[model samples]
Target: MPEILIAALSPVGHFGPLLNVARGLVDRGERVTVLSGAAHEREIRSVGATPATLPPQGDLDLDLLEPDSGREEISGIKRLNFDIVRLFVAPMPHQAKALAELLTQKRFDAILADYGFFGVLPFVLGERSARPPVLLFSTTPLMISSRDTAPAGLGLPPSTSTFGRLRNRALTLLSQKVLLRPAHKAANCQLHRFNSPELPTFLLDVGVLADRLIVPTVPEFDYPRSDLPANTRYVGMVHPSPTMRFRPPVWWQKLDGDRPVVHVTQGTVDNSDPRRLLQPTIEALADENVMVVATTGGPHVSELGFPIPHNAYVADYLPHDLLLPKVDVMVTNGGYGGVQRALSTGVPLVVAGNTEDKPEVAARVAWSGAGIDLRTGDPTAKAIRAAVREVLGDGRYLRRARELEAAYAQRDGVAEIAALIDEVIGERAVAP
Candidate 1:
């Protein structure tokens, strides 16, 4: 059996999906060891994988992955970029050292890594033939540079006209150099330390170098990219094995009511303040003819002091696998994973987010005609109400969403990814 080493950049949103990959590999009879921040050890072992700790390094503050709620959208996004480099990218030397030590202790067949896990770059780019092949897994929409897509984070709609194409190319170049400047430099510095060839473009080149770039979303949902490398693969929605731990709330029957069900969430990572989306959405639909279901992402639901509307139900968490199909529209802070879950179930979205990769996700939601983009992480109830109504009143959004659902049909992303791991490692180990 070929042992696989999986590294998630941080213990935030990135680890969960990587854990799913670990579980899939274990189910296929492979020994998988996951390395991430100290915070995720239990979750890793929960999925039946050995846990490896990313030693505490002064270079990182993983909590900074979710900002403490107070910056203008543009500035917040800029700060987020720097934090990503610090929280995940800048810690490369330490992670690489730890990984190198682990490699010294045991021989592994392949490495599976999250996109932001810059620590693996050195080993991946190393000239040594002894190194195992590495696969970069993306939990979000594919962010690589492409002829058909605008530069990520700008959230600009994909342009089709000659002028639009020129705009995309120009913006892509400018944004890549200017916005990603710190990350590019940080990545190369690590390369120098590890005696690897410096990457020309930090992540884009990483995509090029990966043995396989596996994305969780279906191809139809993403902007077309004819130039996407042969190593890149679209494995649709690598959803985790559902524990069914989240029971429906007492008011769960509200979903079966006459009103359309609108599910609003800020997801887990950035949901520190419910006002970000939950409160606003509940308030927005307080008087609407819709049933509002809000999840606090955990036990914090009881701490919400604001009065919930009569037509709404609030819970600590709800299983998206079970809840999404019943939702007519999802108002979210544009978490890419949650958005994809909503899209897979043919639920339209009203996306409101700006920090991290959310603006890009929101942009795609609008571009796909699957929903409205409120354009800021801190949208008001008025803004949310308007977007929610737009998604609900229009048949176009529903139609487009169902089209994506059709496109997602029959694609088992996790199994394919597991098989791809086998292919890369040449283990050919069938799942027992």
Candidate 2:
């Protein structure tokens, strides 16, 4: 069995799935060690894998997971742009040094990393002659088409005009040039320590750096891109971490006795003001018409201190797979995992908030008409009510979500992804 090293950064959300994938690999007799933030050491160790600590860097603090801490503040767009830089450039050298040392001493047979760790690519590629193969993993949808390509999964009419295609191409180019260049430079400089040549561009650089890319989302939830290179593949969603388990309370049985249910959760990182978001939602639908199951994810729940309505059940978390099948609509803060899980269960959504990748995910949701996306800056009860009504009344959103779920059901993500990793290792072992 091959030994693999997995690198994960930031919020435990992304790390959870990767750890599960590693555990699966371990069950197959492969040895896996995870290099992650100190905050996740316990979670990684719980999966029966070894953990290596990453060197301290700006923003490594796990406290960012807390709501409204104001550790750093910027407009959503600016933050996204800055994050691209930090992921690709600013932290590359430090990450490369740590990874290179690991490779030389530990002799890892393969490397698996979250997509944000693009800086590690050069080191992996530079040592191709001596190092084992590397694979890139993504927990979100990798948009393959130009922005103008009418996003996939959204049931919107396709843009057929030449102008539309041109617009998308222009946006794509601008993002690459203005937002991605500096990040590439920073990343290239980090790799330069290993005596590697400078990268041409962020797009081309990362592309050349990765041998194979495995995205955790199924293609049905995202549009299929004909334009991507052959190395990219869409694997299914990784199961949530075993450490963070949720079981429905006994009262949940009574709550779901008869009525159609709506599962509402703001997720951990984005639930900054769950009462602000959920209280209105509860008020709008509280006539016992449909059971509303809401979770504020701990912090937000405590902050709200509001009384839970008779028809609405409030908690910190719910076993998604257990609750989703009974749910008719899922209201969330545009979390990728929650949205994907809801869709997988054939439930429609009403997504709010624009934090991080929420806007992009919201845009896709709106485009697909699988649900409604409300602006978080000024989301009113009326808007939330309207979105909820549309999803429940129209029937189209639920139908589309079910269609996507059927497609996703055909593929088993965990097993297929494990097989791919095994293949990469097997091919390398026999290469000589």
What candidate 1 gets wrong by more than 4 Å, as runs, is: 10-12, 58-60, 65-81, 427-432
List lDDT for all candidates, in order: 0.81, 0.70
lDDT of 2 at 93: 65
RMSD of 2: 3.5
Considering every candidate listed, which one attains the maximal lDDT? 1
Q: Write the per-residue lDDT of candidate 2 for residues 302-408, one digit (tens) a residue.
A: 56766677788787776777778788988887878778888777888888766666766776677666888785634677887788878888989988888888867
- The TM-score of candidate 2 is 0.87
State residue 187's C-alpha deviation in candidate 1, in Å: 2.0
Among the numbered candidates, top TM-score falls to 1
